[model samples]
Target: MDSIPNQQHAWVNLRRGEPAEALEYRADWPVSKNLEPGEALVKVHAAALNPAGYKLMKFLPNFVANRPLGDQVFGWVRSDHMRLTNQGALCQYAKVREDWIAYAPSNIPLDEVAGFAIVGITAHDMTVKNADLQAGQRIFVNGGSTSVGAIAIQIAKSRGVHVTASASAKNEAFVRRQGADEFVDYTTVSLPEFLWQRAEEGRKFDYIFEMAGVTDPSMYTQSDSYLSPMGFYATVGPQPKGLYLSEIWNLMKTTLFWHLPRVLGGPKAPFKLVCLDYQREDLEQLQRYISEGAVKPIVDSTYNFKDTLQAYERLMNGKIAGKVIVKVNIEDN
Candidate 1:
């Protein structure tokens, strides 16, 4: 392996406003000869493709003059900020900050570790940080089969919370394996109606993790009925324009009808909005979970480094049940 020439391969965007046709397959971009201080030179074994990758590239023309032109090949969240990097894991080797990298679990295959950090951190933030979930609480997860959803389920379960999750009928079993106590098929079931019925039955959740924002504000408005008094709602998906308008209206309604009672009359209501951010400590905790077999990597598929476009396409198609990883290279170490 030492005798193998040091070479790096990457999928680069050379032109603007083009689809996958704009990507340039290259054998060389840049490679670090040695690790800098607080850095580790890793032989990238795998990389997970997030849906944001395709959305960013497709919308690049709106943000930048050159369209899909940027050195940063991948975007990952670090704390509250989004970090862009040309040095994606879709190469033979990558130099990363040692602080940014978590020790991969020994039990999981090396390829699966690539997809762990981003989603793992997101899940940890939503369940532990934003929701402030306590043991024995009941929570609702809006999307059970997504990469982030899978991690959220495990994290919530580990904290001893009971999780009710929504997914397609086909993915119900898969989500159940991840630890969902109840399953709701969004295809056939009316979520808002179902939640209202549950509320009528004296059922409610302490927290709601909204991962599927496909129905705009309707999902939130409807799910609000299922929340217990003083519950929290954390969202990771983008809300539609109309939904944003609806949210403003709802806020106004709350301020007019509910706020006065809480402030002047000393009445209490249950509703809060939360947006999640990634943290290094979350990654470390998730790594421990993965290592201990409490959580497992759910990889939808693996593609070679050159097939990153295909991986991105797979993510955009909404067919993947879990994370999609790209194999950069195999390493003995």
Candidate 2:
């Protein structure tokens, strides 16, 4: 049997109890814990980075917040927990639940699966559950190259829904190749006006998936003007403002100003903030999607496990075509 270490390397949040700007980067730290039922040993290979980590200190409903926190990447078969704690995936070894894991497909590289875990499940939830999209309908996705948006575009398209998306000019071809039927270069064309023009032409989308990264608030608040009469608008990943209570205040303010009005009979249209629930069923579905070639992981870059902080900084910077990952046992995988 392969030997497992009682103490392993990890990145401890030195900034614990401090404010948001207080970053955590100290590595080579120690982590020791025991395994429980439905849990087994795992040697992490690669881990993906997402903005979801910013919510480390924030609150989530228990049903949607079960995973241990990090490690939404590929590792040796072991367990199935995702709502990981702050000192999460960056560790060398983990005791994960068996149900939390889905075996890697032989056709794809182990390192690549790192980016698919969270974004894939989130996109599936948004397109399939929240929006309840149907074939032949139209949909719009902002930040087409973003981790979530990229997957969302493909998921909706696989069901025969027409997809329109906005991205930087440089990423137009990349997004188009990812299955967008119509590509809007946001740098050259104003997104709202472009959509509004289509609305004027009697073309409206049945579903709109907002993946954050859009700066104009009016685009969201005034979507009803361009949305179909009975359409759904859903979002995930709140863009954090300041490091302190600013993040909390932003959520409250959005709920009060945007979501509440849309739900209770204001002018903003039917809207919601969507989240992902980890399930073995979803992972099995993801495996099927991969086997069918309807979706594939898009990796923007990779960093050594020692450079985990640099990887996080790159993800936090918010400029990339796809997912950024940290390679733990990179030399092998």
Candidate 3:
């Protein structure tokens, strides 16, 4: 692509602890430069909004100091000082690291492109890399109805692994359609009992992709019972905060009673609790998956660049069944 103009349109956050209503459209934020060799200045055709996008904005002020505190911020504010100022895919153009850009799948609609990168990378890292899933192995994915869950199921399926997933009753069919071999209704069924039954039937999983946070650590322990001696558990959610005595005691109980034995007696059981950092190579690999039809983007809705707040609102409502996207540049298409 050619060099972009000095100024470009972007949605900016004006203050902290406010809703999407606080975001504003700015036609003059500096069009970020392609400073590095491998970087590409993408004329962002579409961008996807993830749960983290809104949550970060709500909590950014508490995390970063001295930085402008508000909803109108955009892009990385520096590694340690990073804050969500207006960083969702709801804008006209974005200058992304070249390695972070991937070719949109021709099979998927252009509007759905934004939904793929963030959730896709998260699911890929959890299953293919963190869990070390293999063909014929069984894996359980929590939050099967989620965007990340949808992509993770497909990735595991493509690798020839059998999948058992948990979602609401309403999303059971959706989960199965995404290649889940088994579906568990989290609301109705006791997860541990269900896993125990599966184990009694001689069906044990090799990994547990714990997309849901520590709301139920016993679920992890129960799932561990059915894991092949050396299975792993990986989580992408935020850790609980404010160390209370009860919280510490609960943590000790879960660690000693549930997580310890799996770590000691069985195969090297790896449990991860960390944030995902995207790399250029991972983007390339994701592009290949898109091109080869191993994975597909799922979009729940799209908003025009001007209606960026509406996009964020829809994501916050939690009613969206797939990725929420923003069409950043209508004129270009």
Q: Rate the local accuracy (lDDT) of all candidates.
A: 0.65, 0.68, 0.64
Q: Candidate 3's error at 315, in angstroms? A: 1.0
Q: Which stretches of candidate 1 lie over 4 Å from their true place?
A: 1-6, 17-19, 34-36, 58-85, 222-224, 239-276, 330-333
lDDT of 3 at 171: 87
Q: What's the lDDT of the predicted structure labeled candidate 1?
A: 0.65
Clashing pairs counted in every model? 2, 13, 12
Clashes of 3: 12
Q: How do all models score by TM-score?
A: 0.79, 0.81, 0.80
lDDT of 2 by residue, 1-333 (tens): 125545666544454432235445444455435666777546677776666454452211110111234333342221223435334665666555567666665567767777787778889898886777789999999888888899999888899999999888888889998899998988888777888898998888887788864433556666787899888667875666565675666566556656455456555576667866667778777767877888898888988867766776776676787877777663543
By TM-score, rank the candidates, best first. 2, 3, 1
Point to the candidate with the largest lDDT: 2
Q: Write the per-residue lDDT of candidate 1 for residues 17-126, one digit (tens) a residue.
A: 33386667788666665556875555555667765455454211100000011121222323221234444445565555555655555676766666767777778778
Q: Report the C-alpha lDDT of model 3 over 112-204, residue by residue, as the tens digit.
A: 555666677778788766776779899888888888888999999999999999998998888898989989999998887887788889998
Identify the superior model by TM-score, candidate 1 or candidate 2: 2
Residue 176 local lDDT, model 3: 93
Task: Give the higher-TM-score candidate: 1 or 3.
Answer: 3
- The TM-score leader among the candidates is 2
